[model samples]
Target chain A: MLFHVLLLITFIIVILIYEWKHYQGRDRYVFVMLFALASIYLLAAIVDWRIPEYVQGVDFLLSPLKKPLQAWLDQFQI
Target chain B: MEQKISSIQFTVLVFMNTLGTAIIFIPTIATRYGRENGWITVIFATLLGMVFILWLTTLIGQEDDTNFFKIMDNRVGKLISYCLILLMVSFIFFTTFANIWSIAQFVSLQILMGTPPQVLALISTFTGLIAVRYGLEVIVRSAEIFFPFTMLSLTLLALLVWPEAQLIRVQPVMQLNQAATFVGVLPVIALTYMELIVMLVVLPHVNDLRQAKKAFLIGGGLAGFCIIIVTFAAIAVLGVDGTVRHAYSIYVLGQNIQIAEFFERIEVLVAFIWFITIFFKVSTCFYFLSIALQHMLKVKNYHSLTVPLGMILLATAMTNLPNIFYDFEMMNSTYLILSYITGLTVATVLSLAMLIRKYKEKVK
Candidate 1:
């Protein structure tokens, strides 16, 4: 995991360097955003975080509606 | 956005895009709930998905040739537009992540049992990144070349496997568990149709925007039709119980081909079709992600982010999703709703809001 994290960071640095010239003007924001996103992913992977859990909140919120939705659709099943 | 694709390319790209991982899973997932009536869900989902594509095109129609992000920015304010962009970006990225994971799982399980999942995930994402790096034109053109092979392979497989199908397997005709059948509709729609959201991104890049409607219908309809055939084939060939028992019903279906004594083991050809379709799917998602991020961050070029995004996708694909069971649960339930409702609600609201604003201006 640690090796993977290092590898990801190394790739990000190479990309940053390769695209450094394009970072002029508003493109700098993309540079920053890409760097930050890649870093977060690297960090998350290293920590072995179950990243799906972060997105599962939406799943939980929508769970209550599934049954009712299913019941309603069942009416036409016959 | 300087490059543009013709309607034919757009249509073919749509077919490839919609074909994604659903081909592998829908047979089992749909039949598990809808039983012998699983094919019915395909027809229903296609019709309903047609309505959705119509509604989406109408939304795009209101904006002339403006891209989705700008349309959103204009309809809702900047902040809300940014929020929607985040939602869309996450949605597309998550999709790419999921597909990478899925293909990795599929390859490791079926094709290369000895390969590490992480290696497979990287290879899958890398192929997509290469296409994305060249821009949408490369992706669409490659789809043009790949689309025929995809369809031809599917046809050949169907022909080869048709003889093995026991029509009796699809027995007890309309005895579907209504609730399960209806609940079944969500995943099929989510898996196949909701992906039309990518159309919104690609539309502005289309050469003749007027052909968007026709392109969408033919492409989406054909893609849905393919799924229907696959579902029917799986049920007829494997039956509901057998279909549900296998992780990849389509892959298993391919394994059933026993022509002459020498014509066995044709799954390699089938795997090729799966590879290109999933590759295009991931590339399409990755394309949209880069474009959306460029717009959101006010970047000038989208290309530079491709490598970074690919890296993120690799990491996420490797570690983000839980085990196969959890992944399946999410796809059938939460993801089905989240992908469909969130997209439909947002697009409808934005379109209606745009229409209302037009009316107010006319009144004034």
Candidate 2:
């Protein structure tokens, strides 16, 4: 946990130093977005929050078709 | 000045990327559905994959210095191209996370039982981050360096394990349900070649366009051959039941290797092949994500984004993909479907669009 926190801090520092050193007008928003994503990830880790698995979402979307897909695939089963 | 890699380096990257997680997981999955006929399924998948690669190279066309994004933009216009690029980026990101999580999971379970997965995931992500920071030239060159040793080790493992291979175990060949063998090809294709659509991003970076296409085919073909050999060896040595029983069947095959009562229990040492290949896989995916993000964000340099992106990947790998079982379930189901949709479907659509545009111009 401490290691994760320290790692997150180090990442934040690196982001800041990188943006400072390679300050480009177009990349400012990109860095800001990255920083926001990093902060959210850190907060989730600290809170021990279960990030919703993207696969689950995909599974949910495909659930209705799962049986049909299986049945279709089964037709090929000799 | 733009960085470029030679065709040989590109081939090595393709080889490593195709082997990626497939090396660890292919034998089990192939044997599960195809049974003793599993190796045949892999061969079938490779043939299909070759067709897919040929199509992809055609879509990339005669351009010496263009990427998938540029091709899509030229054919389909900005809005549609952006949409497709975003989808490709999402797919690339998912793969990067998957590779990171897989290596971490393997290390935690097999080697460092006490280490937290997050730490392993961070280490994997950091390695990729460092590679990405140096750019494509370094990444491909490193892959080139590691390619020979990884292949040699794999070849040695194959040769040493040959003594244990019982032809009787692989008997009754091609007698399995033909449908099942065909069905087995989907996952193998999805995991190996379809996942390789990420390479299209780096295709423009290869110095020789024509040779790079040939390299692509050769690399993918070689990797497929490796998988086929490993799958056959597992079946011949461990039999179908034993192959499907373990999560990492190739590792189990390594465990079965005994040479002159001296080289015993060398699975850990044999695992070096996977470590090197997976590192290249993760790094390649990470590099793709950085490139995709740079294009999406109009960033001047991709270097600045790798650290934060790596952090996010670490967190995601830690938070999601709770265990190997979940990953297996995902891989067998949703990931397979997603691969087809994002990989084949998208590439086919882009290729058709390019054809229509060309036809229209010719008519004009």
Candidate 3:
């Protein structure tokens, strides 16, 4: 988790520098934020603590959606 | 605003784009009709893409220096053209969403069980957004770098799986009905190749469009070869029941192999290889989406639209997907048909009507 956080910090700093350099009028800032977001997300994923909770949440959200949609397509069964 | 990609780069890009996730689904798709004709379905479907390559490239070539949006302006009138352009953007958005989230499902299931699908989707979207920011030039270059490694890993796996391959698995070759084979190929035809229509934007910019066409054919051939060999290997080892049940049959095959007892459970290496494919795939879609957004919105810089567009795709993936099983059902049943039929023929005629008008305008 610390490694992910450190990587995220490093990427955020890099993005800040790249954005500052955006004064020169290149599009480097887009890529910079991209990496930064990627790093933060990776960090969160590594540190994900609520898997059981998230799993249940997903089931709650999806069950209503999945079953009927499947039923709607029963006629098209192949 | 960017320069055209060379034929070789386009070659690798198309290959990386076409080769993903198609391998695993072949048996599933084929089983619906017949097993013997699985390879035949790939052939027929690939031929449809190949034909589209000829006609779509030629149609765009007539507009010399034209891209999809410009062609749309001439081919279709402004209002309808704008609507179609929006549809194209949404199409790319939805397809990218499915692909992005599926990668998550795969990682969670095959590599890191219980890893949140959102985690993979988020990482992949961010990585894709970065690639989108770089534009096509960097994407083409990165594809070159990853191309060799993807080939090497796939080859090594195919080689390893050869030992356990049973010749009997492919026997009873005529088990599938000849009449149903052509119909069986529809999903592949529609999904894999129909998406090539999206390449209409990238077509005119290809250096030596003929060579680009050739590269498309070659890349497709390479994919088909990989499909046949891998399918054959799967059948040889797992037979129909085992192959059908196995989600990551190739990865399963990889794990099942001994390779001097040192190479057991090496599917993670392959999971990484697929990571590379997903990288190129998402980037390609994101890049195209950016360009299309620029054209549609008349933005001077595509980079500005990248974040919002990525957000939209993320939303599309998040909305209504519900779970991995639905995602697979969508990909296998709905998406393939949509991409093949709706993507190829329906979209083609719509665009072609626009192309014809453009050609007449140029002629006049």
The model with the greatest DockQ is 2
Worst 10 residues of 2 chain B by lDDT: B62-71
In candidate 2, what are the lDDT values of residues B208-313, reduced to their tens digit?
8899999999999999999999999999999989998888889888998898899988887557998899988988888888877777777878876777788788
Write down the DockQ of candidate 2: 0.47
What ordering of candidates by DockQ runs from best to worst? 2, 1, 3
TM-score of each: 0.92, 0.95, 0.78
* Residue lDDT tens for model 1, B243-277: 88887888889899999767897977668888989
**Candidate 3 global lDDT:** 0.66
**Local distance difference test values of all predictions, in order:** 0.80, 0.83, 0.66
Off by over 4 Å in 2: A70-78
Please give the DockQ score of every candidate, comma-separated. Answer: 0.39, 0.47, 0.08
What are the interface RMSDs of all the models? 4.0, 3.2, 8.7
DockQ class, candidate 2: acceptable
True contacts kept of each: 0.45, 0.44, 0.03
How many clashes in candidate 3? 5
Q: Candidate 3 chain B, which ten residues in sequence have the lowest lDDT sum?
A: B337-346
Model 1 scores a C-alpha lDDT of 0.80
Cα error of candidate 3 at position B294, Å: 1.6
**Which segments of model 3 are wrong by more than 4 Å?**
A1-78, B62-66, B177-180, B345-347, B350-364
Write the residue-wise lDDT of candidate 3 on B1-364 in tens digits. 6468898888788877776656555655553444555556566767766776666555554566446677667666777778767656655666687778778777888878888776778788889998878878788899999999989888877787788887777676766466556665655654566666666666667778778778777776676666666666766777766765666666777776777877777766567667887788788888778887677756567776676566556544544477766655765454543454435543666657856867899999
